[model samples]
Target: MDLAFSPAEEAFRAEARAWLQANVPNPPLPSGDTKDGFALHLEWERQLFDARYAVVSWPEEFGGRNASLWEWLIFEEEYWLAGAPQRVTQNGIFLLAPTIFEFGTAEQQQRILAKMASGEEPWCQGWSEPNAGSDLAGISSTATRDDTNGGWRLNGQKTWTTRGAFCTHLFGLFRTDPEAERHNGMTYLLVDLRQSGITVRGVERLDGDEGFAEVFFDDAFVPDVNVLGEVNKGWGVAMATTGSERGLTLRSPGRFLATATKLIELAKSLPDTATPELKDRVTQAWIDAHAYRWQTFATVTKLVEGGHTGPESSMVKVFWSELDVRLHEIALELLGPHAELIDGEFAHWMKGYQFALSGPIYAGTNEIQRNVIAERVLGLPRK
Candidate 1:
């Protein structure tokens, strides 16, 4: 694949860079997990929507410019370089909307994707449950079709829901047929967060924040049209989204490039304290970030040529997540004893360290990802 950007991509990059330099939050918005922060980010999303920067790869009817994949990557690079606020609508824009576009009905796409892009209705993922985390096939949540109501009655609990605290909607998986075996008899269901009989309880994590929550569905009612794909085949639909999450779509290489840039500056600040070994490690981190960037470009090239992302997504996920953990570790090492502090100048890296550590566990654990690579990518026996 050609590493150099085309003339058009270069022009797009220049446009995005200028816009971001002018529009990024001055003081920066608060964490979107908090109530006040959510409002701030919501308005910021609306601004991006108005500018058609929310999802450039989407069609104009869906509030995007119908930009090419390369343009989207260029936009991401500019976005991170500008240090813009994190996206609060990622669950909808990145994760759910892809599957929605692939499997949703015309009415569903018309109603959902536009609102999601405009931040009029933000969404959260409701995939994991008390019984199912990495092994999503073990999920016990059930969605039964209601003959009387002409819809589905959802009754189950989902845990570790990102953005659960404030999202207005959720797209999730539920067992539509208990008699069927694992990975079978499930349905992808969409439920309104404000609907009755649904309970959302936040869970505090190492970050001392309520970024994740547990959502309980006590006979929650969902309209029949809310189903994304066919009943008893939700596993396929859900995997498509999960593959996107584990691949370059969710965690763009731009983020790692930005982190690497910060690490380089930090290393310069610690010239006297930086040992030869530490310097080498920092350089390696920078290389790893570039490697991911190249890998993403290559993968996108193949995808544009009509190839699909498969178990290779797991490999990408494992590499980047572990690289994130290592990058943060190096930052802490640079900060020395001050790394433990959660306030002042050190708070930034400390917060990043906490978040990086969780990256390996979310989407799918590294252990699970490795197995997928071994069996699917390497053609090894699953047993």
Candidate 2:
């Protein structure tokens, strides 16, 4: 199949490129790791929102340009090519907004999507509990209906919640019907963090950044309207959310391309003592980066053609997560003695390696992705 954009797509690309060139800034290189740089990145996101460039794929009614998926890919490609800062509203716009648009009621969409798109309501995913990391079906957070009141009462804890400390809202899955099967008994709930019954405590990462948090719900009240999708059909909603997480949100080839370019630049500036292995590693990183770019092109084309991502998005997830780990590993190797350095560019690489360590863990672990490839793609027998 030819992987070329049409004339209309080319024009869209040109428009996006011009807009990015005119508005985006090339700031000082990111300091520390992901968490340390989150706030600054968020500011950059607000700037994009103000310019109407944040969510390019959503319908125009929800603050996006209603561009086709192909145009979305082209816009993202152009944005990264211009060295623009990453958007902090990514989790909100990419993951949550799409779910809301597809599965949420019209009123729900009206209440949530605009704030999310405009960066007025930052959101965090509340899927993984301490007891249920990869096995999301094991989540035991309870959301019982309060007979005396006209809402549900949430009571449980969520861990490894990214941006939990600062997020205004949380989208989570809770056990709504204890008698039903594990997956069937659940419901998706939107928790307003500003409410009285919720508590958020920071969890410092290996890199000493407090980006993730543990959130507690002590009888937190959520109106019936806050329930996402159906009350007991949250498993399907979560599955779709996971698909979006894997397909669209987490693995942006444009973001990785920008990162790969930075890695190449850093490698070039290293000492002559750089080992042959390190050089080879850098070369392989570039190749993998390019592979992911082409894969994204194919994926976006499929989306434009009204085809779902199927198991291929899982393949993309595996590719990018492993590439990310390998890239950071090579960076750490290149840093050599400075690998342990806690400041400057060396520190940034160290912090990135620490965060990259989680790639396999989040959005369903790499092991899970492999299983998906086996069972869904290869038609392997489930043991």
Candidate 3:
């Protein structure tokens, strides 16, 4: 793939940069403790939506430019470089939107796509249950068809649902046939969080943020219209979504590069005498950050050339997750005795460190990614 951009592409890049310069927020919101930070992010997303810059990869009919993968990469690069505020609708725009585009009916698409694009609705994932974190097939949540009710009756508890506390909708996988094989019995459904028989309670993280929550459904009814794809085929749908999550959205190298840049800046401000070892670690973190960035560009090129990401995305996930942990570890090191601090000037780094600790765990754990690489990529026998 050509690394050089065509003249037309360069012109497009110039236009994007100009628009972003006029629109991108300066001193982007500190990843902080503000209760309204998420809402602030939502406002930023709406601004981008109005400008037709949000979800640049989505089809034009869905309020996107239907940009090429290269164009999408360029947009991401420029957006993050400009320090644009993070999108509050990322759960919708990044994860659910693609899934819906692939599996949803035309009517379902018409109903939800516009709302998501316009930031009129916020969506969250309901994939992880109390017993089904890493092993998604272990889901006990049931979404039984109610013949008389003309919809599926959902009754189950979903835990670790990110942004569930404030989200208006949820896309989840549930067992639709108990008697079928564990993975074969599931169905994916989109639920209205504000409807009757639904309850959401906050789950505080170690960082003291209620960024995730437990959601309960007590015979909640989801209309057949909300069912995504065919019933009892949710496992495949979920696999596809998870692949995208672990491979694309969550592992975007541009996001990690921006994060690493912040860490480097923080490291430079720390006292040199604090710890020589800390400096070395910080340098290594910078190198890893750049490595991830170039790898991401390569991945995007392959995708643009109509090649599947395959197991290489698993490698990306592993690299970024581990690098994230290392970068935060260096940050904590630079904090010295103040490492324990969770508020004030260091609060942002502290929260980031906490989030980075979870990087290896979410969107498929590092161990699982290793298993994927060994079995699928290396052709090794499963243990």
Candidate 4:
């Protein structure tokens, strides 16, 4: 149960902290979700890549430092503490990369990971559809075999894809068998978004950023080489990605801890507005962030001891997403009327609050996560 970092770990932390302090943009770059801002973010991504910090825990052969998982956690804490730009390439690094490592061939690994680390080709998730938001098994997108073309022909649409309009690639699940229903007969496809028969339309989010997109496919062809894992066993493969999305990888405690620290500072600056209830909430949020941090460390330790992420990730998802909302809510409350400002000093709080609102809805809704916990973690009956 000990949580102390070893001398080596502490030295690693110091090294990461120094580099980030020296490199992170002083004024901060614009949101990576916007077109112009995305360009700026790409520049920042390249800076990190050049420093070998883009994918620290990845293999050395694939544009990474080959750091241990504990070091990875330490790096995340330092990255957020430095107020680094949003990782425009996160969908690939955090979610899809692990799946590729687990299910991809050597050729696929060589083809994908380096470009991803360098931000030469960014990736987005194509999970939710117009009809299949939470129940991903209900997606109607299809990828039929095209033996003549030596590929699969995709024909359907994916909606609410984060940064879909800006990304160069996509990783998603598609029904490969016409007769099969639900999660069966699906295939995981790595698609080039620039290819023919594909359309990406940006969707404006509550924060006024075009962070979400709807992607359409009509007779889009993907070479057989782009397929990850087995053709019709995509459900399992995709679950691995989703497990990361909902688990420790995607929404790390570092993010919440950073916000909580900001929240406390904001509260301190507004002593007059800090009523007892508001003060208590701020304290609670800070404590929750620390609790989550230690909890995540315990999980990481378990993983080091050969355990795996699973349904318990659902619990982690629900807690962190809700914690995010609460932290931002308190920030907005502290800002008072200034929270309504969309420009200047108070703008980030409002923007963060809006983004926080979507946390429960994406990465499978909190409601859906609770069901996963019930059925898989608690072993409850489906009824």
**Candidate 1, position 30, lDDT:** 71
Candidate 4, residue 277: Cα displacement in angstroms equals: 1.5
Give the clashing residue pairs of candidate 4, or none: none
Q: Tell me which of candidates 2 and 3 scores higher on TM-score.
A: 3
Query: What tens digits encode model 4's per-residue C-alpha lDDT throughout 1-383?
Result: 67688899899999999999998997988898999999888888888888899998888899788787788889999889778899999989888898998899999999999999888999999988999988889999999889999999999999999999899999999999999999899999999999889999999988889999999999999999999999999999987665552232646678888999999999999999999999999999999999899888877887778777778888988999999999999998988899889899879898888989998998889999999999999999999
lDDT score, candidate 3, position 109: 94
Each candidate: RMSD: 1.6, 2.5, 2.4, 1.5
For residue 154, model 3's alpha carbon misses the true position, in angstroms, by: 0.2
Model 1: how far residue 208 lies from native, Å:
1.1
Highest lDDT among the candidates is held by which one?
A: 4
lDDT of 3 by residue, 165-215 (tens): 878899999899989877898999999999889999988877777788899
- State every prediction's TM-score relative to the real structure: 0.97, 0.92, 0.92, 0.97
Candidate 2 deviant stretches above 4 angstroms: 29-40, 245-247
**Which parts of model 1 have CA positions greater than 4 angstroms off?**
244-250
State the lDDT of candidate 2 residue by residue for 303-322, as single tens digits: 56766767866787888988
- The CA lDDT at 126 in model 4 is 91
Give me the overall lDDT of model 4: 0.89
Judge candidate 2 at residue 299 and give its lDDT: 70
The prediction achieving the highest TM-score against the true structure is 4
Q: Whose lDDT is higher: candidate 2's or candidate 4's?
A: 4
Q: Taking the candidates one at a time, how many backbone clashes does each contain?
A: 0, 0, 0, 0
Clashing pairs in 2: none
